[model samples]
Structure formats: C-alpha cells, structure tokens
Target: MINSKFVKQKEVSISVPPGIDDGQMVRLSGMGEALEGGVPGDLYVKIHVRKHPYFRKEGFNLVTEMEVKLSEALLGADKVVATLDGEITLKVPSGTKHGMILRVKNKGVPLGGNRRGDIYIRISVQIPEKLSKEAKKLIEELKKEGL
Candidate 1:
C-alpha cells in the first residue's frame, strides 16, 4: 500500500494488478493536485517486475531451457522439467537434436480471466568433450551401420 498526498490532504489507495509488465503504469483517477473547484488531477503509478531466475517472459508466453545428455538425444528419454506449475516429466523424443524446442501447455504467466500462457523449453544437448575408447568404438560402429 502507498500513501499519496493530494490536495486538501486527501489520500487514495491504489492496487496494482498482477502479471503487469515492467515499465507499465497504473493510473489512479482524481488522485493528483486538486483544481480550484476541488476537481483533482490523475496520478500514474509505474510498475516494475523483478526478473525471474528460471523463466523469461515473451509477450504472455514463457521460455526456458534444459540440458539433455548425448545418449538421451540418441535414444528417447523422460526428463523432469521445471515449469510454472511444478516439475513435470516430459518425453524427449528419440534422435532429438540440439536446440530443439519443446512446448508445455498452459504453464506460463497468467493472462487474467482464467487464462494462462504456454511455456517453451529449448533442448540443449550436452556433448562429451572427451570420449572414452569404448565410446569412440561404439560411435564408429553406429556410423558404419549408417545410423
């Protein structure tokens, strides 16, 4: 709650709505300097939302990224990802490539009126910097098989 001092020492209450974007302003009517006849001016309250650690806002949608192992990219794997709701298991398709996008429905910011946005997850495949001798042999075998 904020106290605003208008003319005649009158105070007004302003409530900011949720899901407001940064640099957006909320206007309060008749809460500014008063005119001669007791008419008041309007007051604008600017809003600022702090950055979130795990998510970013794009319009009404949310975006985040998750890392997947190289083996998971070759073969399908189930991954538990963090969303607005909570941690949920998502199916990482077999042969999924790096920088693939996965969508989680209705897991974004609130849009009001009982509506919400979606969350997009970018898959980052972790490549092993140094492959073991056995791992290199297996990769060569798979390449020979045209996989």
Candidate 2:
C-alpha cells in the first residue's frame, strides 16, 4: 500500500522474513519493480541465497571437482566450462585420468520446483614438480607408449 495506484500492478515475490542473513535483500513497500515506461514495480527478496563456498548441493544438483593439469590431462580439455553453471559443458578427456569423473547434465541447483541438478567434475592429473627438458622427453616417450 505505497499509496494505492489505481489498479494495474501484479508482481510480487516477497519472502525474507526469517531473520534475514543469507546475504540480505528485503526492501519492499508496495512491490514496485516492473519498470518499462509506466514504471512502477519492485519486489525482490534474494536474501543471499547463492551459497557456493566450494560447490555442494544435492537438490537441483551441484558438485565440484576439476584440477586437470598434466598438460590439461594430456592436451584434451576444451569443454570444461563451468564456474558453477556457465550453461553446462564437460568433456575433459584427452588423457584425463586420476579419478576422472565429469558430469554436467542439467547444471544442477534450481530447486524452484521444476527440478534440475547435476554437475560433477572430479579429475586430477598433475604431476610436474620440475620437468622441463621437453617435459622430460614427453614423459620418457609416454613411458614407451605405456602411458
């Protein structure tokens, strides 16, 4: 009831009255956040609900893992774009080893209700403390093709 505006306002989302703290965002009076020309709307209650310390969600899915280094896992890494839902792309497989586990279906974590959660990238192959001479002759010719 910002002052009753005739009639033609229907946009609400209000939901942050539980002590507010997630990140904080609850400033509403008449919910005015439409803005287009007749401008007159504002209703957003995103009380800091974007938690991603290290990525860990099970509902609406979201997991985290990616440490490929050994030359991008034997030079085979291009579809590894996902800083936590950059759309969805995970296909790290050149020599991708060391616990390899890449899955980015759905992109995980929406929980709005429709349901959508999936993002797991656990690959770790990086062991080059100090090997330069052409990467130690390509790791001794890939250990004589033994890889």
Candidate 3:
C-alpha cells in the first residue's frame, strides 16, 4: 500500500492469477479511496515477473539451454533437464545438432484448468578443447571418411 493524501494506507493481500504476464494489472474492487458519498474506487496492481536463472518464458512455454558433449550429440544419449515441475530425462537423438530444440509436453506454464504448455530445450554441443593423440588420430580418420 502506498501513502496517499486521499486514500488511507493499508496492506492487503491479493492473489495473482497463474501465467500472468509482467506489467499486467490486477484490479481489486472497493480497495481504493472512499469518497464522501460514492463507492470506493478500484485498486489496480501492476505485476512484475522476475527473471529466472535458466528458464525463459515464451507465451506459456518455457525455453532453456542444455549443454551436451560432442559425443553425446553424435551418438544418442539420455539427458536430464530441469523444468518448472522437476527434472526429467530427455532422449537426445543421434546426430543431434547444436541449437536443436526438443519439446517436452506439459512441462511449462500452467494454463487455466488442467492444460499446460510445453518446455523447449535448446541443445548446445560442447566440443573438447584438447584431445589425446589417439583421439586426434581417430578424428583425422573421421575427417578422411567425410565426417
């Protein structure tokens, strides 16, 4: 509550609706200043959503980046991803490229009723900085094989 010359300062708890966007307003009737003979005005509260450390919101969907090893990108591997609900195992298909997006259904923001959005996982392949001699030789062989 803000101190105002017309309205009295009083704290009130307001329940925000789920999946509400930032800068959206929530109106509370009869929560504002009371006139001499008129009804009380409505109070509007603007919402501001804090940025998450990892997840980014798009509509109701949540997007996040996951780093995978080069070998894992080449060969299929099971990867664990953190969602708003919890951690889930995602299968990375073989030959998965960098920036590949994998969608996990029903793991995103909750819509009205029992419906929910999905989570998109952006894949980031991490290549080895240094390689052993044998590893380098195998890579050279792969290069010769048009890899």
Candidate 4:
C-alpha cells in the first residue's frame, strides 16, 4: 500500500523479479495522476536491497570470505559454511592458497524457472600471531625441510 498525492491511497501489487539489483525501477502503468481527457501517468518505484552481513551479491552470484588456519590451508579439511538455503560442508583441498576462490554450483541467487547462480567462497589463510615454543620448533623443522 502506498499513499500518493496525485492518486487515491490504494493497494498496489508489485512482483519483484528474481536477481533484480538495487536502484532498479518497476513501473506501474495507469497508477498515477489523470487529467481531463488525458491518459494517466505511470508510477515508478525504485528498489533498494539491504546489505547482508555474511554475503555480497554480484550479478546472480554470491560471494563470501572464509577464514582457514595455516595448518588447515596446508592440509586438507572439511569446513561447514552457511548458505542461503542452509549449512553445507565444503572441502578445502590440501595446499589451498590464500585468496583462492572455491565455487559451489547452483547455490546463489534464483534465476527463475529452475536455474540458480553460484556461490564463491574466498579462502583467507590465518597465520597465528603468537606461536608456542613447540609450534615454533615444528615450523623451524618444516623450514629446514624446504617447506
């Protein structure tokens, strides 16, 4: 429902299409002002999408960042990630580097019918700020092995 000075206050049905971006306009024909013996003007409504705390949209694709420990990046691990549908487990291959993007197919924005976009997860390798003596020794040993 909307209130307009040029038209009577009434309820208007607006169907938002899938994958519509912010600032896009939806025109409502014959819903504006009408003059004597003249056609009524159209009403234009602009869309504004609120930002998500965990994901950002790009086209139909959704992007998010995931932090992995240094050991996890070096070794393979299965991590649980939150998705629009629900939570899913993602596999991080061994030797996965920082800034590597992993794609989960058909997990993004709806594309009408039965199609959907993809979700991109960017890996962020977290290095420990403070290392224990034993951990430092193990890293030193790895360095000696040309790791």
Residues 13-128, candidate 3: write the lDDT tens digits.
Answer: 99998888999999999887777898988999999999989999999999999999999999989998888877889999999999999999998899989999999999999989
User: Which 10-residue window of candidate 1 scores lowest in summed lDDT?
Assistant: 4-13
lDDT of 2 by residue, 18-136 (tens): 22346667777546645456655655465666666767665555677767788778878765455544544556778678987778765666545555667777777878689889879
lDDT of 2 at 110: 54
lDDT of each: 0.88, 0.66, 0.92, 0.94
Across residues 1-147, which tens digit of lDDT does each residue of candidate 4 receive?
A: 896455478888998898889999988888877787899899888999889899999999999999999999999799999988999999999999999999999999999999999999999999999999999999999999999
Winner on lDDT between 1 and 4 is 4
- Sorted by lDDT (best first), the order is 4, 3, 1, 2
TM-score-superior candidate, 2 or 3? 3
Checking candidate 4 for backbone clashes, the offending pairs are: none
Model 4's TM-score against the true structure: 0.86
Strongest candidate by lDDT? 4
Once fitted onto the true fold, the runs of candidate 3 whose alpha carbons sit more than 4 angstroms away are 1-7
TM-score of each: 0.80, 0.33, 0.90, 0.86
Instruction: For residues 1-147, write the lDDT of model 1, one tens digit per residue.
Output: 898654365566778775689999999987776756888788888888889998999988999998999999889899998877789999999989999999988778888888888999999999999999999999999999997
Residue 136 accuracy (lDDT) in model 2: 94
